[model samples]
Target: MKNPCVAHRGWSSRAPENTMAAIRLALADPLIEWIEIDVHLSKDHVPMVIHDYTLRRTTDGKGDVKKKTAAELAALDAGNWFSQKYQGEHIPTLAQVIKESVGHCKLNIELKTDGIRYPLIEQKVLECIQAYQAESEVVITSFHEGTLYRMKRLCSQIRTGIIIDGWRNSLPKELKELGADFLSISYSKLNKERVELLKNAGIQIMAWTINEKRAIRKIAALDPELLICTNYPERWHELRAESMELEVVNRKK
Candidate 1:
């Protein structure tokens, strides 16, 4: 069975977080069976693949992502800050990323709604997914409950998940009510007891941004079937291989 190690932000530890350069590299690597990217509607209502609400952190632009038209967003240098060697790389629209990844691998497209909300973003993102006929290959997730609610209402058949970083007493009940397909939770919140709870509820679990070697092994030991979201998928693969090898040696002994 495949380990299902997801490349967070397109193998972001090596490439610029959400740029096409990152996405393309991840697609080319066979180790990365799943790629996670963030999505926000541009001013023109185009779904764009980017992590920040503002352009300052990842691109050379100055304002909010929703303020810029798709073309304007693509015009800025998104890779220069990561490294001068990647000077000309630009932000990719969600369509472009989907075009590159539709058949090669699955995507976990995060419906990014932080402080500034993009009104009607769920419909816009749905349009992009339908346009490419990638409804089956994508998993839409968000921290906002309303976003998931809207997405489920828009198309209940397409898989949707809720991203959680904290635990609450009502969580299992809330999740059961929400009817989410999976729970993408923070690494700190993942453990045997919680895993059993979610599994018993028939909810799939995904742990995110686990980059350290120790953390990777710990989670993999807890549940190898998890969709382990990591910045360095290469590291996860190495550790997974080592674990498998050790298991084989023990069996032979």
Candidate 2:
């Protein structure tokens, strides 16, 4: 199967990461089968789509995102830092994202709770997914192994993945114990051998945030099931077209 391209935080390279603008842009791209987004629970237990735990970086607001209610978060300007064209874009709720993207593309929701804990976050996320009837269209991932475990226990039908920055010697074993469906790793840490190992163990691999042509070619050669990229789904489409052309030429020769 041709590797699918997942737009990281929507078409984040062009729009404010995690804003509705980016999500809409990614959904419009036929090449983007999956849109990956980060989520943090607001004080009111609403799942707001934003990368950092703090609002200072991505929004006009200052302080921890947990301190703000969903309504307050909804009013913050999430797009001005990226460019003037996106001046008033607001952070979207998970429900809003799912409603917009259900039939258009799959969602890869990363639970951003590495250092902090949001009690019952897994349940809240699941409720949103169930409400939208998007069970088949969503994959929940996290660096927190405990969260994945809790997610599986809560809903065995939900597909889950583990996100890692670097190679882990015990990943295969942990995945089996955790019942994880796949592994999403930093593209810089991937190699053919590692890919083969995971594939042999019946685990799917996804490489993230890769944009350079050379890096894309290298990772593409490994044939990961998903290639997560920011702002450049077209580049992967181009590479796939070239690969198909090469195959056709070889057959003719």
Q: How many clashes does each candidate structure show, in the order listed?
A: 0, 0
Best model number under TM-score: 1
lDDT of each: 0.86, 0.87
**Clash pairs detected, candidate 2:** none
Residue lDDT tens for model 2, 27-105: 9988789999999999999999999989989999999988999999999999999999999999899999999999889
Candidate maximizing lDDT = 2
What digit string (tens of lDDT, one per residue) describes model 1 on residues 166-187? 8875677777777677889998
Off by over 4 Å in 1: 114-116
**Per-residue lDDT of 146 in model 1:** 80
Candidate 2, overall lDDT? 0.87
